[model samples]
Target: MAQDVLESPLVLLDEVRAGLQGGTMVPYLGPGISALREQEAPMAPEALADFFASKTTLPKRARGNPWAAAQYIESYRFRDTVTLWMQEAFAAPVPPSPFHLWLAGLSLPLIVDTWYAGEMRAALAGQSDWAEVQGITRAGIGEDRWFRFYDEEGTSIDADQAAKARTLLYTPHGCIVPEANFLISDADYVEVLTEIDIQTPIPEEVRQRRTGMSFVFLGCHFHDQLLRTYARQVMKRSSDHHYIVVDPETLTRNERRFLDEQGIIAIDMPLAEAIERLLT
Candidate 1:
């Protein structure tokens, strides 16, 4: 990642400022953020998910759909096996990147990310006070339990005990928490979809943070409806306050429609450039 491009002089800084000063900006991060590490480590959950799906038989129609492919494989009673794979892959400690560090340093009101490796807390370390909420899944003999991971200390705490106190790092998707266990399959997604609906009883704290907030989606890919559906967990489907950064060439029609219908705006730019603007 070119930290230089991520410096100031961003074309979108004015727009980002509008969201910030208005008290509506919430940063939504994703797997591509970790890939930004480039040379340090490879903690991309998409790749991990791909590795699991590759070992099993994915339905023909689900060729490019990882979650769907996993669901197809789960139908064969191998979900637990897949969970184990996730556990081992996500258990290691992967350091947060400069982008993560800068974001955490800001101590923004709300930060939402889908990087299930639990790296945000570490990224926010020593910068400001922080709380983390991760949706974790544990598999039993024949069942899976979906629960939230909210520990005051979060994966770690850093030097500046004072500034480090007030940030909230959230992972809306299921994490491996212990290893090889996560929310995978059509059934798991159904639960997530329901959990984010209007009637679902989400935590008062989470609800409070998400309500009345505008969003800046960075390094995210809403390629699947399930993912777009998942976004509802953060903001309403009809919300126009949310904005996603994208590489225009890769943005498909369905992707644009899903975002548009939900009132989410798309900004065409590479992730690094977008992140830089937001930071500025």
Candidate 2:
């Protein structure tokens, strides 16, 4: 770990804007984006349904607070049914939020995130300019196709269009398409932490687009040990750019010191609000 050599914390957003003006900007997303849009409370995903169910099971005395009870029940237990009920409940074509729109306006050639490919693809497709730029993810082949890491191994090669898609969205957790393959279980997470290197280019492809862009990490928890491995790779591979991370909660002393050591720019603020501030 090396010192960050930070100029100032408050000016991170301005620094990002200036950095982007120099070249394309990459937006790397995390779970917080989905959680926020879903209006999930600050609780673990598995606990939600049970918590709500318990509340709804309350006696008549608690019926006056039916909204809270209903919310708990709906949020907690819906996972089992989301696959079948989400479309009717929330609709599939829901447009991206203002923050997402702003992100697409950057016109970056690459959009890499750890979130589900569907939401981010929807966001990018919603943008006029970005719509022309096909999305390549580990998800599907429509607008966003998976990176097809298997492509690297010489199994599934990319067609001319896929190889040249304006935007390549790679998610380590896998994608929705080709079945629910995104990494979630403990074993899957361990595999991601141990395998997969995004820094190096696959055979025949120009070494994973390294230059001409800055990475803006949003809603990342940095808790995954593998994430640190990725960070280390980026830090070691490049010396010409900076990486920005946004989290509304202020960083802890240890975390700050670690980031400072690594030269990572950590912004203290919620993702949506921070993007708003930067755009303005």
Candidate 3:
């Protein structure tokens, strides 16, 4: 086993930083990375359901499912308005989280934002000229990279000129904007399998840099097979060099087994503390 197999979050963060600086670590961003203070971030599924209820009554089945709630609300009502409202809920007047600012400054070669959100992208944009490849935003950063494989398809910014700026943000689940690109129901989840082409863009430069590297999954929840898949994708190198940071409160027996099976080092701590370790 690697010497870091059982290190504390502090030590683990240090190791991760070394890999990142050495061009051997990829930081995968997720919704969990958001420190949505005073803003409407779903602390839990129920909280999201309650918030969605204010806009339109969500069926009991859709109680804990924001995607379903959002999809259902948009089906009969205004899709653009609903998605924009959800985006605004995140875009509310809150300063960027310290973790994001720290992440933006890092010279990492590549960043894979699973689903789309403009918050981190916007924050990072302030730090560097992050090229948004296949994105969905009102005003794009520049011409899309080769990763924008599908033309004018799901989450394409041109889908709606008035939708919202910096709208494309990829989460562990999928894109949060664009009603068509939304991964809400079961079909949507399965659909991601078919569209795996645009999943993770490893630029030739990034690929070379990633050799024998590790991964640090930020704002990721790894308590189930669903979220576990996110860890597997980014750490596909088949080496025991990846680590997952999840809230200790949410860690489960099943999650433990999944991590062990995948050879992943799991840190049962909150991101705030982990980031502090990295900063100091």
lDDT by candidate, in order shown: 0.61, 0.46, 0.53
The 10-residue segment with the lowest total lDDT in model 2: 131-140
**lDDT (10s digit) by residue, model 2, range 59-106:** 453233322333333455443332223222223343456666666666
Tens digits of per-residue lDDT for model 3 on 56-147?
A: 77788767666567666766665665556556544443345776676666745555565344345545656533333332222122534323
Q: Which candidate, 1 or 2, would have the higher TM-score against the true structure?
A: 1
- Tell me the deviation in Å of residue 233 in model 1: 3.6
Ranking of all candidate structures by their lDDT, best first: 1, 3, 2
Candidate 2, superposed: residue stretches over 4 Å from native? 1-10, 40-95, 127-160, 177-179, 189-207, 231-236, 245-254
Looking at candidate 1, the ten consecutive residues that score lowest on lDDT are: 1-10
lDDT of 1 by residue, 1-280 (tens): 1222243434445666567555568877888877776523235545754665556666676566656666766677576665655565566677776777777767587778776665676776666456665554433435343444444544433323322436666676655442323566666667656656763524345566777777777778777777777776667522365666666568778786776666566665777766666566
Q: Model 1, which residues run further than 4 Å from truth?
A: 1-11, 17-23, 39-46, 57-62, 138-146, 152-165, 177-181, 199-201, 237-239, 277-280
